[model samples]
Target: MTERHNAFFTDIAEATRLTQAGRLGEATALIQRSLGGANLSAEGARPTDASPAPHGTPRLEGPATRLDPEVDAAQATLIPERLRENIDHVMQGLRSLVPSLNGLTGGGQQAPGPNGTEPDGVASEGGQFVERSFSNAAGARDYKLFIPSPRSGPRPLLVMLHGCSQSPEDFAAGTRMNTLAEEEGVYVAYPRQTSRANAQKCWNWFEPGDQGREMGEAGIVAGLVRAICAEHSIDRSRIYIAGLSAGGAAAANIARAYPDLFAGLGVHSGLAAGCARDLSSALSAMRVGAPGAAEPGGAAGFGAGAVTQKLRVPTIVFHGEGDGTVHPRNADAVLAQAGIEALTPRQEGGINGRHSYTRTRYADDAGRIQVEAWSVQGAGHAWCGGSSAGSYTDPNGPDASRAMLDFFLSHSLTGGQG
Candidate 1:
């Protein structure tokens, strides 16, 4: 192996030791330094020098989608067998320490059909699941809209974004949000990420162009929301957004870029807004959590001077203590960016205490919950309390869908202090 690969292995070993010794912060910093700053992509590619965009705008070249094989091959191939085993061992231990990184990346198992649908016994009998598409200046994208039957007046809308490699149907089945929406008399929308946008069908939450108001994916999604509101009798004040993993990260970006558009937000296994600008930093943020901040240049379409803001939307976060793909520490970083100084005493219980979790509520001085965090013990990257019919789900965990709905119902744009 070359000198750089040798150093990476050394850092990996040392990080493992530190993690075992319970010095996670030091290990994270060490790994960060060994990786050589933040311009690195997830696929181990370095960014080329490109002219910076106007202040508060994306780079002129946009985001890079693939890694350079010639540059990254050595790093990829030189990983010694022993070192690979050691890394796996370290990850297993870290999962125990973290508790939330339990499952492997992506949803756990695959279901059949285009939408990954199987008959769901728990799903409401008469709900409508309609496929729809919305377009704007940016582009057109497809989405699945679910409306519970027998709704009389305007209903709350919840936009659900799926993680990488997951479709709206898979997400709906996993989270069982549609069933819960039926019971709660809420409307649900699942916006799908296309392969043309991302090969893995993941939202480009890490891309600078996609992070701004009315710019890329965020803008497209916002347009979809407005169209939905116009067509359906949506309660604008009660509209909210939530997602898992990449979708969760995108939800954070959306809430940051368009705070007025959403009253509350839920992020599961997700990072905070502006936590990463490229794939490399995104991987780092997922592995070791980064401090959340807005990009330096203002987003193009929000207004002349409207920069991405620190999160002010009322929010709730759920992460596995052992989440290996996206570190559990990210939940804390999300709360910190929300300007939460302290949290209430944690309460513990889930599924009659069979699947234990710790919950803490962050409230404003007015005693309104601005943020809530749940750390599921022994849970992994999958959705806690999710169904097996869909991908990346942990049925034994508490019902995140139910909890999010309860939280969303309690807050609104005009009255709630998010």
Candidate 2:
């Protein structure tokens, strides 16, 4: 068979010779017919040995699969040696375009598990950064997972949803929340919303249609939470949710629906429930600039009326009193809608300036749950302690990262059947 295959090409070369030597017409007909025959015969021949068939015997065949010849050639010929080098070069070029991935300074790899004992190549723990995709009733979504080093037992999980126009990497860089995760020895997960849904990539929290139990945006966020809990050492009693702006609104929706999954929620310059019925309402609610804008509903059952469930999770609110977009008053309305009253104010100073806080504690039939509002004077609608490199962020506001961690650690969740 190998000989026959070689002979086929050999005959084509001879045909070329004939054409080159003035037998043009004959070479042309023979070339076309012979090429057709070779293709037909090649289909049934083994790749290892391209043999021809004997008389009265059909050629032996293997399963036929479609493939792209160029792709196959590239993988077979070009990819192996060049893949790593090309990736490095491309990543270097991308650093200029997307600088956040390169800005994170601290991440180290732990010692590999003694001699491949664990499966999935549990090599050294590198920064606790991991990612995967999952599908639910709605669709498939990508989720970034971060687990703290030295996992002794089940640890609390914190889900951080990024704000509008921010990716997982951007959020990680701006918040520097990974530093908190490493200190607390807890896992952190960030679920990214696609730009296709909203151009700004904001979570659709204003519409009642999206605030239900694991349905739309809330469902996708919860799906990532469930996936992380399944894959890592997660503490069910201490699961928490937090986000900024649009993400904060989405976090509220998640907490409202799956109170069992999250022990508390941390919101920054965000809208409360029932204020938005759609995108327009959501934008309006965020930009109204009125103090106490959070008190449930101004539009009759819009978001003013608190749900009977009492938003079982403890809450921490961060809003700049001088914010022009979402006013500090909206923070009041949010507290009112959640049925929490402000507590005494305390002051603290550190990286930026001294911050004042007002806390409210709520209790259901179970026990006591806390809700606090941190109103920073002169701050805008930006991340309180975000880095200066990013837009719409303030490095001088109160340190929300530390505050959220402390509040989340203090609370406990009730149910996990979901």
Candidate 3:
């Protein structure tokens, strides 16, 4: 009963069946073959040198599937009218959103998947993933905490924020940051963004209400971090925050808001804090660098002399040169916003094989490294040196987890700032 007309639908159904049956590797290949995508991992990465993004959830970009006019009309109700648009228009909008909608659709991930991944950080690799929550005057947020093996003294804390549409589990699997925590005796916390806040589960870094030091999302996140520090005996001087995409953008803003709280910062494919004030400007910033920023989200967005007056913190940045979702110029904008432009950087080229990159490092008057940036060659809006088990990861080269953690630990909060 194999009908020639039903081949495509049949293949799709079989792929779904395989995915549900936990044959992720095979299901991914079939979906790619059926959809005419390149040989790619479940995370839209190549298993080898071809892969080069991290923590950025895979997008649903593909050749438009044309249907009969009657079929199109019949399926119009499948999507809400307000959300309906031509493929090009929808793709353009999605690009600006810097979305990670893969989990919502349930296409590929598996339970008890590779690297011992599980929902809510359960079934992890030799560490405990505990669920926790924090509420403040601003709002409430739930988070997952990764506790390393028993240690004698205080441990360093790393606050990790996930990209749009990604959860703590997905981000952990992608970046393998928790693995680093286990190996290095560090505590990791993942703050969740509720859908009630943003439809995409994106951090509201661009919103004026959320950017304040003691208001909105920034306050709530900082409160949570402080609570964790007290509860887990975290080293205040060693605390750091990092995020991918919107989370990265949020990290930048949070660091500025609470300069004395975090000692180091990491932004991966993210925009600078204060890059935009609302959705419109956020979209523009994500597309092209913020031209009106006065100094890449500094003087204009915050105020005159706001950044220069603040204490400096050590920071490390990672961005793919080919990131289409978030303009690569945003990276330069981030450095400028951090005031690294005032210091001359010693540039190094071609570190690590396959997905070669150029690294820039800057030091201060004391000869201490203050800032580092990685410009990944031919990479895109994803986490670098991540595992393929999670969404938005590219298993290429130049491990971001190692590089970021090393950078964070090397600098401690001395006199309330790095």
Candidate 4:
């Protein structure tokens, strides 16, 4: 058996043994360790050439916690047939035990209401939540909008894209963006990815077709933004986009493709655009950061002799130093891709009450802050300073959403309407 598969079974066996011995904490830790890097295909393995589904296949809408068929096939091939049933049983046991363990460990449980709103008991007084949809030639996507009441005038719009396996409500509850929006009088838009496009509901950032302007998911999201702006009194110059994980990668892709559409970009736990062109390369980039020199043309096909004006939109990046899924080094790669230069030495300390972080500020020739990279100490592949109400959040890290908003609000498009 390959070492990867061996390690997987070994960890499972060890976790099961620990659970049987009543050492729940150790068992849980073992399970979490095993889960990390679990999706990686075996080294030197290539994905099978599976044909696309028929055009009439109904698109699945909702949370995507299940594995994709391609991923399942790859995983199934790794394990021996005899061990498959045992692995499944152990996983089921872990799933049952995790909730109880979480309760003991003070993990927050999400209480989702109808239409992805908070439970009725929880008051949503300050802002109004509305579900909206946008369609274009690229595709159609549903989104959740949080509009603060009593708007004095045109307010800034913040486009939030959720990570894989996350919903708009869950993302909002975790990031607490709605609360911030109410305080700052900002409009928040959350574009939801459908399972029809990606089984994991992740933006297809690795696909070349999705990396350009007016194309693929990026085009669809931009269309949604335009529709939102047209419908609401929004400051087109103050529009911004931010996201986490796969969504984070998509945010960068959008910013690069449509720099005129956003004032700034925020990427948290995401890879740089054009870092990978396929699943294997993407996995490698996530595991070891992007290899070789940074991509030329600024990740948006803005090569020399391009007719349209090109601008390096302001960017802010946050990464957990201990992120096993996307290495922290990817943050530097992103900064480099954006042509941001570090102006000062890295500073380390507990900026918040939670995790200590090493922060570095970058600026352009004009001395304006163009990029800021924060490496949160002792954090995992989760949203920093996020509420436990959502999945993949670490409450013990600096508030990324607030920081991104502050950065976004501080900058405006140099010369663009929308």
TM-score of each: 0.69, 0.63, 0.69, 0.67
How does each model score on lDDT?
A: 0.72, 0.59, 0.70, 0.69
Report lDDT (Cα) of residue 63, candidate 3.
19
Where model 4 places Cα greater than 4 Å from the true spot, the runs are: 1-111, 114-124, 292-311, 342-348, 415-418
Angstrom error at residue 60, model 2: 63
Superposed Cα deviation of residue 302, candidate 4 (Å): 17
Give the Å shift of residue 189 in candidate 1. 0.5
Q: Residues 6-88, candidate 1, lDDT per residue (tens digit)?
A: 88876766555445433343454456567554322344432232322232322112243532212323443434455545545
Across 44-112, the per-residue lDDT of candidate 4 in tens digits comes to: 132222333332442122222322222224445555454555555666776566545543322222234
Candidate 4 residue-pair clash tally: 0
Candidate 4 residue pairs that clash: none
* Backbone clashes, candidate 1: 18
**Candidate 3 TM-score over all chains jointly:** 0.69
- Stretches of candidate 3 off by over 4 Å are 1-125, 292-311, 351-353, 415-418
Clashing pairs in 3: 53-383, 53-394, 54-382, 54-383, 56-392
- Candidate 3: lDDT of 137? 70
